[model samples]
Target: MTVTDGVQRVLAELQRFGIDRQDVIVSTNVRTRLDGLPRSGEREPADSGAAVYWQERTGARRVIAIDHYIKVADNLAAIAATLDAMRSIERHGGARILERAFTGFTALPGATAPSWRDVFGVPPDCHDMAVVRAAYRRRASSAHPDKGGSNDEMATLNAALRDASTELGKPIGGEGS
Candidate 1:
């Protein structure tokens, strides 16, 4: 399909994650929507990359800013699915939205660091299950799709939890996240 088609599909899917398009500010590789508003004459810096924003002003349950490569064609399916998985945190009222947003960003073929920078901020060297169950779980629950997050995000969390548990020698359903 075309880029416009992809963008439209993405917009439609965002609703499923409880992200209202009205509350969004779109800046596509091809155009900008908030142009009518007072924009700083300055454009995004060279490496800043493209992004999608959703938030309270947009009346969304949460805001998700996704970074992507402009050269590659956009894929709405995975994005929609990811958002759905992430709904647990994005749709509900809470702040874990920050971590989810950062951790879950994807990249098109040629994307760079934004796509690979441990968005979750969890260092590979850091293995503190006690911290995950006690602090991380509480922090993440605020936006978990099951609790208030989107389906896509909840799915992502499920996977991350599984990975963390397997390595830590714990079950996903255990007392920790």
Candidate 2:
């Protein structure tokens, strides 16, 4: 199956859960360096693919990355596996399990840090401080060292929050009134 087919299958599954396609945001043209690329030979360049983000009506959010070189069958299988895992977590641990799973993965070397909007999982035009703070809390909670998270992850989250605050022109402590 093609990438389009894989995306359609996932979207159709989401629709079965009563999610609108619009609510299931699909982002394309994300170019991540592919592993196992031929380093010393003349070969086709690495794959640049898409990423999908969905926030369930129940507030469970997931991000799935699709490689440009993935086959339709593999993509479909991945979607199926993810759904199964998500359902199991939902059944056993509820939203907390989903939240814990939502800690964004580590970026590969040479990858630039994501923008504040991306870190907050908000639209580029979103400027509401409330929304930014909410996102920051959700992300920071999972990255905090006391919560079994790494120092590096926490540092990144802190940097993102600072950047977000600056972008919104808000004092970190809500002072300067």
The estimated TM-scores of all candidates read 0.33, 0.37
lDDT of 1 by residue, 1-177 (tens): 444455565567767655666765545344333542112233434443334566754444443444454331243334444566666555574447676665556433543332111424466666766554454465367557658767766555555655566777876556653
lDDT of each: 0.50, 0.64
Model 1: CA > 4 A from native = 32-49, 57-72, 75-78, 88-177
- Which 10 residues in a row give candidate 2 its minimum summed lDDT? 36-45
Clashing residue pairs, backbone N/CA/C < 3 A, model 2: none
Candidate 2 segments exceeding 4 Å error: 30-48, 66-73, 88-177
> In terms of TM-score, which candidate is strongest?
2
**Model 1 C-alpha RMSD to native:** 14.6
